[model samples]
Target: MSILYYGLSNSSIDNCTDVDEKVKHHYLPVCYGTIFIIGVVGNITALLVYLVKVRPWKSSTIIMVNLVVTDLLFMICLPFLTYYYSQYDSWMLGIIMCRFTRFIFHFNLYGSILFLTCLAIFRYVAVVHPMHANSIKQKRWGTLACILCWAVAVAEISPIFNQIEMKLQDNKTYCFDLASNNPEFMWPYSWVLTVVGYLVPLVVVCLCYWRIMKELKKGPHKESKKRVRARRLIVLILTCFIVCFLPFHVLRALRIYTRLTPETNCMLDRWAHAAYIISRPIAAVNVILNLLLYTLSGDCFKQAFVEMFRCDRLVSKTKDIVKVAVISKPTTKITHDQSS
Candidate 1:
């Protein structure tokens, strides 16, 4: 999900004035409420699988953990938003919670993108340069990458707090996303985020996956299993990119350009605004899809899930105990025979 879309959903003062109130009063709440339920379940499941079942020090686990954290953080903020929209634009939560909520949304939006980029780069190195993957795939480097991603996401999105505020209008309070208030800053910021934060990373993911597929095709027949797995991961990445982020950037670009136009009328504004409201939820649900994607991408996720839920270890211990009992019984019988 693009932060710009999320900002637009919250900050569009024009929306309260122009778009159909029923969208906010009735339908929007349902969408966000559903998101809240599913996002919480999926993100929590992913978090536990990584934290408990998977080894923390592995490079892949590092990226997966951060991605899950980002999603979980966003899920945590959904209740506040769900309540706000449920009230039909009333915001009794004050400015700080408003800003904090919006800030967390952006943090999740960008943090997910950055961490995914790291995963793509890591996979590229692992597949394309197997021998050298060992050096850069160290836990320390993964930790450093995660820290850098968080720091950069924070720096990029912190200015948003200045643009957002609570508004009292028409007997209702509104948590307004003021991103459009300063068109100059927002326009450039949107472009930078769309390109550098999202587009560039998306391109990198595609390129790496494409290269990986090409290499897989060239390998020997015994590597066919690996090739098939690589293709699945590539498909998963591309599907996620297309479904979650593409519409957001396209609509965002249209929204920005429409705002810049001198002839921007009510009809165009209404369409763009409503489209964003509907599409934002779709993007938000990507966090849930990400958990699914993680499961499909590797056997490690499946094994972790089994470890988290199944009694495999307990069964193994029981078998060991039974073996010990059998051995002792044979030894005692031999001793009794000798004594006799």
Candidate 2:
């Protein structure tokens, strides 16, 4: 979401034009391609695993499935971005497609954040408030939450249609970035985005995990294997937020602030612009982290992956067994929730 915004408009020195086009031209495609490839492969594989093996999804897993879907949604837009940057902001796609891709990217960005927050909260309920968790963490609630997240994210990003425009510059038409050139809309909408979209979710996740940690510290439950795994997953999610999302938001906000504050140092502004650009890809790294969460958070997910890979471990004498396993009709029956 925090992809491309540049230096101040009225800099005493070079302005947004000074924010190295060559670096942006080379950097974005590589980052977008890498993210697209890895996210697509990982999310698709997770979706397949869930569909084929992870039976009877729980509330948390259902949110995770939504996350995978969000990642895939973003993945579909990356190719257009990749091609756009490969030609250095020369948008071959029409204006409608340009705006559509921009919308999808922001939608995925915020949607993923909201879904992750829901995930952490549901997990907190399960770990810290198990007595009431059963009532709160139902599939219906999860489905409703996912729908709400989609609707809210869409509303948050819908204004981009006004902010971004396809403009002609030096005989080339370029689709604007999230950091739109319209000063009227850029900083104001961005500050709102920072507060409501970023900070609110961060605060909620932090609060949920803090309560979970406090609960874990109350007694000998810390020593339990299940609680230990929960602790690990909690740490993982928090790390993704702090390491990936926080820096991006802070740097992007700083960059935008520099753009607004005319008296800002051009050198500092350039550095901040560069830092913000770098942070864009860092935020995208969360998809890989989410893939890790999917594997570790559910025993059925882990078990299915293990079972699928067991064929490699069979010995020469088990060739007949492997053959039978491959050829025989599957007779495994889902008799219960089998979550564990």
Candidate 3:
């Protein structure tokens, strides 16, 4: 989600306040709370399964781990936001924190998507260009690529620092999502984020998956284990793109277009903003869906994930049995004394 969406929420309408603002006040706390809880559990589980269970990590594992790290970082920022929206009138934190918090969300959004794009690219090379896959699949290459993705993400999001500020209006200090003060810059910047951060990666993922699927169909290994993993990976990543990325970008663009245009009816503008509000948290769903992508999508990771969960279940059951035994011992002693 673009940072300024809530800022865009105030809108070009004559009234300083609108329905979007009211909706945001009630909507984001619940959405943020839900995403935060689910994402934390999912990501932490993925982390444990990877860190403790899946040993001897590969290039793809490196990328997936990096993706998880980004999601975790983003998850860390959610509680503060949940609190922010719960008491929507003002920001308890100052501008510096407001800027830092905004930056973390922006960083996670692009970083997770880019890391996911890298996975798609890695799969494309592995399946479609086996001859060169080994060279590109080296651990160092994965590390270098992750470094480059971080650099690019930082450069792309650097502009957000200037766009955001804590606003004091009517004795309330609110940290604006993006300061509405500069529509000239914010409107165009939103498009740049959608294209570079959202659309371009989406196009790349589509092309990669399309080619991978085409190659798999004609190959003899169509039913092979690797092929099955590739197919699953395709489904998971595509779901994320469609559910988490597409709607938010499309709706945000529409909202921006309608807001800036003259002669647009109030109803249309309100609808646009409302749609944008819905899509914002929906886009954040990537952090949750990403847990599936990294675990079930990878070859060794999938096999290991199953074993790890079984191990955890056994451990839990063992603890319960021990607890029961300890309680039974005390009751047996009391009965023996009474009988004597």
Give the Å shift of residue 133 in candidate 2. Answer: 2.7
- Model 3 per-residue lDDT tens digits across residues 1-340: 1224433443355643367767777998899999999998888888888898787777887888888888898987888888887886468878777887888887888897899899889889988998988887678978988998999899988988877867666676777664233556768888899899988999999999999999989948679876787788899899988888888778877776765665666667666777787787888988888876875655477667769878767878999999999999999999999999
Instruction: Score residue 331 of candidate 1 by CA lDDT.
Output: 97
Winning model by TM-score: 2
How much lDDT does candidate 2 score?
0.79
Candidate 3 has a TM-score of 0.83
In order of lDDT, best first, we have 3, 2, 1
Q: How high a TM-score does candidate 2 get?
A: 0.84
Q: In model 3, which runs have C-alpha deviations exceeding 4 angstroms?
A: 1-18, 179-181, 306-340
Looking at candidate 2, the ten consecutive residues that score lowest on lDDT are 1-10
Q: For model 2, how does the per-residue alpha-carbon lDDT over 1-340 read when each residue is reduced to its tens digit? A: 1223433344335334455455567888899899999999889988888777787777777888889998999898899988987887788778889988988887887888899898887877887778977765678888988898988898999998777788776666788777645655678888888788888999999999999988888877568877787788888888888898888888877777777776776667677777777887788888888988986675478777656656346654488787787666343233233433
Can you give the lDDT of residue 317 in candidate 1?
A: 90
| Descending-TM-score candidate ranking | 2, 3, 1
Q: 1-340 in candidate 1: lDDT tens per residue?
A: 1122233433434433445345655767788788778878887887788777775456777877888888878877788888887877778878889888888877787788888888888888888888977876688878988999999889878888887766565776677543334465668877887887788889999898888777677747836665666777778767767887778767766666666664565566557766656666777767876777677545377678878877588888999999999999999999999999
Alpha-carbon TM-score of each model against the true structure: 0.81, 0.84, 0.83
